[model samples]
Target chain A: MKKSFAILATTATLACVLANGTAQAGATLDAVKKKGFIQCGVSDGLPGFSYADDKGKFSGIDVDVCRAAAAALFGDAGKVKYTPLTAKERFTALQSGEIDVLSRNTTWTSTRDSALGLNFTGITYYDGQGFMVNKKLGVKSAKELDGATVCIQAGTTTELNLSDYFRANNMKYTPVTYDKSDESAKSLETGRCDVLTSDQSQLYAQRIKLATPDDFVVLPEVISKEPLGPAVRHGDDEWFDIVKWTLFAMVNTEEMGIDSKNVDEKLKSDNPDVKRLLGVEGDKGKDLGLPNDWVVQIVKQVGNYGEVFERNVGQGSPLKIERGLNALWSQGGLQYAPPVR
Target chain B: MADQQGGVAKPPFWNDPTIRSVAFQIIALCVVVGIGYYLFHNTQTNLQQRGIASGFGFLQNPAGFGIIQHLIPYNESDTYGRVFVVGLLNTLLVSVLGILLATFLGFVIGVARLSRNWLVAKLAMVYIEIFRNIPLLLQIFFWYFAVLRNVPSPRQSLELGDAVFLNIRGFYLPAPVFQPGFWVVPLTLLVGVIATVVVRRWAHRRQEMTGQPFHAFYAGLGLMLGLPLLAFALAGFPLAWDYPVLQGFNFQGGFVIIPELAALLFALSIYTAAFIAEIVRSGIQAVSHGQTEAAYSLGLKPGQTLRLVIIPQAMRVIIPPLTSQYLNLAKNSSLAAAIAYPDLVSIFAGTVLNQTGQAIEVIAMTMAVYLTVSLSISLLMNWYNRRAALMER
Candidate 1:
């Protein structure tokens, strides 16, 4: 009995000591670096955002962000390990160090930032809540959905927003909520819900998957602001800066009209701003603790912000999401990047 | 000579076999404790280094997210502790309903498997084979995705009689809006149960003393029904029923169960019932044929023979496995997450974990809740099983 007590006591003491001292520093970032790869969390399957193709290889706008991070760090985009997570699992995975960054079309919210301890790198997609209903319902406006059954994905801002919208309008609604976006979309497609509410981008993705794509129409109501972005775990200042700046670099490159294809040509430009951005003059990379050609490497490897968006989710793709608020600041949109110098 | 040899051959504590075994056990225990301590210490150290708080003080903070199907009143400002309770209650709600439904369905199918009629027996066999072969998760998805998802819109809802409306959204029925004066109904029912127990005790005592069978069931039923009717009259007929009605596009003034909950419960109950049926069948078969034959030989009718003799014996084998099946059903309720029923796991483990990013605490709390539920169920079932076994003896 005495021996057992001694063992328990020692165990307790050691647990306290290790928990207090040994495990809390830059261990996570160091581990990632040592492994020569960054683990990125992505959506399980959303076309144009993050989805597997016929060969089961992931390719999307979010996937490119992970690749760019890897290229900036290791000079190889393929060094990223993609961990596909559902909406419910994505945040926890980031918080628990299961993944280094979450680029999964996650909305930037105050609660997520402060309460969940996540830092939004920057908004990638400016989205808004929209409703899609079958055309045969003859309801063209969201105002007509007073007593309609709305299918909303649970554990999301969408559910809360949907509730608030209907309550404010003094209209009653029964919400059929699913844990996954696909399930909720499926429910709407199969007529389990009168209307499906989600980001307008998601609505477009879901619409095409319907048996008759022309049967459903997205309503004109933009209910809430959904600024989706890449998020990093809190307390890793260095890693957070690397991710944030990488995204900013892409946006700035696009604004300067220096894309992946013409980046090498633009390196010889006489423009002082373009020259400095291409690492011709200033030592910006040294401050960020990256290679002097980090921006060049990122652009060469992942393309400019506009190119990535077009290839994955915009005009060149099936989703066809217009560059609305996501357009460049010079083009009258919300996206603007700080000067590299 | 044996005593002398035994005394002379006594070993020292270090060389003694029993002493060595104890020593080994102590060493193993120490090693496990050391590793556990190392892990705990490392985690705390890391959290501290990162300036993260270790304790569950975060539970008191406001859960900014809202739940879809809260049985209790909740808002964005509700505390995480309240969310835990809501989740626990939801779990209990599903378990209780699943248990009752599974029991009813299992018993019928179990008896059908051994039916004298060929069609009945064959049908029960088919039901068992088909349901038991599929995974529960797939079944939940199929029902939620392929079946319930196809229900009609509220404007064109399929009406099952005038009392129920089946729509893409949910099942709407006249929600029982309890009147204040309707309290006498439940009170009367409680009185009826007490009256039945009193009459049953009287009947049993009389049977023991005089060796004559008394009609305890009928007399108990009479007292139970009489008291309730009398109470209802004295209370001036306080009870009223709320009839569900359709108004405009959707049904109003009715209780609604969303399609998610419906799909989850439907899939869980049907899938679990198949296994329960097999248990019930084997339980009945475990009782010898002689028990039934002997009961019939004593001039008892088929119903009486089977109920008094066969069932009593069969229950001995049934209770243990039946309890396990109930527990399995309870655990499987976690699959409600797939269909988004806002059950304990979906709301707390999935949503709360995502929002809070406290994987260890969230998972631990979830596991603890389940453990408590499973243990409580087992404790209750064991008590009943003991009583049943004692009666047989």
Candidate 2:
């Protein structure tokens, strides 16, 4: 016990030195560059958002966000290591500098941004709390969910949303919460619960993995706005700007009809807007502390935002979630990015 | 030769053993305390520098999640403080229940292990070896997953006399609802309890002073039961049991024991009882064989010899280690978080800490609660040990 305490004290002391004793500006980026990689935190196993395959390789939009950031910084997408964290452990991992960027499907909330010493870079996926019920139950909607036994995943916004929806409708229900989503799904499959509540995309993702996927149906109700994003620690504005703009750069490339396939050809085009963005007429990466070809490396390596989505959660993936709220602003969606130039 | 003969003279203060020992202790204490203070201050400064809020104010904010089981009233809009209370109560409920069940089962197995019957002893031995060797978490998973398998879903519940129901969701029994003037029944019951105690004492006095035996057992039992029955008759049977009815998706209006609680209770008691059985067996064996022989020579029955002579003496050896086992059971009850029992560690340290981002404060409070609980158990066992101590004087 004494030895563990001594070790803990030494660690805390080292953490203090790293947090305050080092050169006060751009420390995270400097450390990342020195360490030769960026430590990125993602979900433990959220399907299509960071779940690992049988080969232990992680794929999803969240993982791509980190790869895009890494490619922009080091020009090598592989120069990033993944740390999968649970919902409860994600914020602390980011705040403690255990990971440089928390690209997990974490919702951007006011309390988390202001109080937890975290600054959300930008929303990567717009999600909402939804329910998945067995088809045999014949429950039509969330309103008809009165007196239902709802299985919810702990440490997420779904639990709170379920409670609120039930209370608002003057209904009573039992919430059987579990730490892992798989456990909740198992309970639902066994008829232990009448409803399984989670983000809509997650419901679809979990549905396909069920023993009989056709038995479950995702409800149409979208209860709460969960703008999932990547977050950086509070002190490093330079690092924060890099992380934020990496995502915006991807979205802007999508809006401008550029992708990994046509990026080299687009460099030869005469469009002034594209020229300034691609560092042909103007260098857009200097202020953000990057090289002139950072955007080019990102596009070449990670593709545009739409491609990431389609490859991970869109038609190319098993989830096949539509980009309803995630399309570009020109397409009358919520995904609007500021002009690059 | 003269100095050796006169060596009993008082030594100088600096060279004295007492003074030197005291000095070393003071130095050691200062170093320990200084390290503790440095660690605490360093944590506060680091937390502040990192801009994470560091205070107990978050506990007053609303806890926006729901718990599956709460012994008291709870709502989603309640404060985090209420959440802590709910989690603490659930933890205590599980720990206390587990301890009681483990003690009972442990004593039974422990005594049976020493039985002359070969099959019974071997059965007890097998049970100990099987349960003690397996990990408690896996056992919990096994019980929770495989439990209620034969029981159908809520739509096809197994009913008991049209008042109780058992299904996949839980086991539900009729909940007792008291109507107007129900207090009269309880008040009469309490009166009967007091009367039974007084009658037992008087009977004991008569047996001792007049050399005549009284059937205080039957008299006490009669007063305890007959008075309650009489009160119910006079008060027009003011108690009613509300039966559980099948509702939209589950049963409603019943006292339901959720599967999580049942699975947790089974795992905790069965696992802890294995260790406790060994402790109890050793305790009973520690008592000399001569005591049993002497009791038998004095014309005592085998049952009396075991309970009156063996158990009383065995308690002295049992209690100290028994306290440790009880503490283990209580601390291990935190594993309830695994299967969603809404215990203190999960609800308070997990969900509350996540929502508020007060890891340090939440952890400190959780550790303090466990320490308080363990210490309370230790103190209680110590008191009992003192009473059961041998009176050598």
Best by lDDT: 2
What proportion of the true contacts does each candidate reproduce?
A: 0.41, 0.50
Pick out the ten consecutive residues of candidate 1 chain B with the lowest summed lDDT: B45-54
What TM-score applies to chain A of candidate 1? 0.94
User: lDDT per residue, candidate 1, B210-300, as tens digits?
Assistant: 9888898887787778777887788887766565566644567677887777777877888888988998899889989888888888999
Off by over 4 Å in 1: A1-8, A15-21, A24-29, A136-147, A164-172, A286-289, B1-10, B16-26, B50-54, B64-66, B75-77, B247-249, B390-393
Q: Candidate 1 DockQ category?
A: acceptable
Q: What residue pairs clash in candidate 1, if any at all? A: A18-B41, A18-B42, A19-B41, A19-B42, A19-B44, A19-B45, A20-B45, A21-B45, A23-B46, A24-B46
- Candidates' TM-scores? 0.91, 0.92
What is the C-alpha local distance difference test score of candidate 2? 0.88
Give lDDT tens digits, candidate 1, residues A91-195.
778777889999998899987886676789998889999999988889989988887767877667787788778877877776666667887777777776678
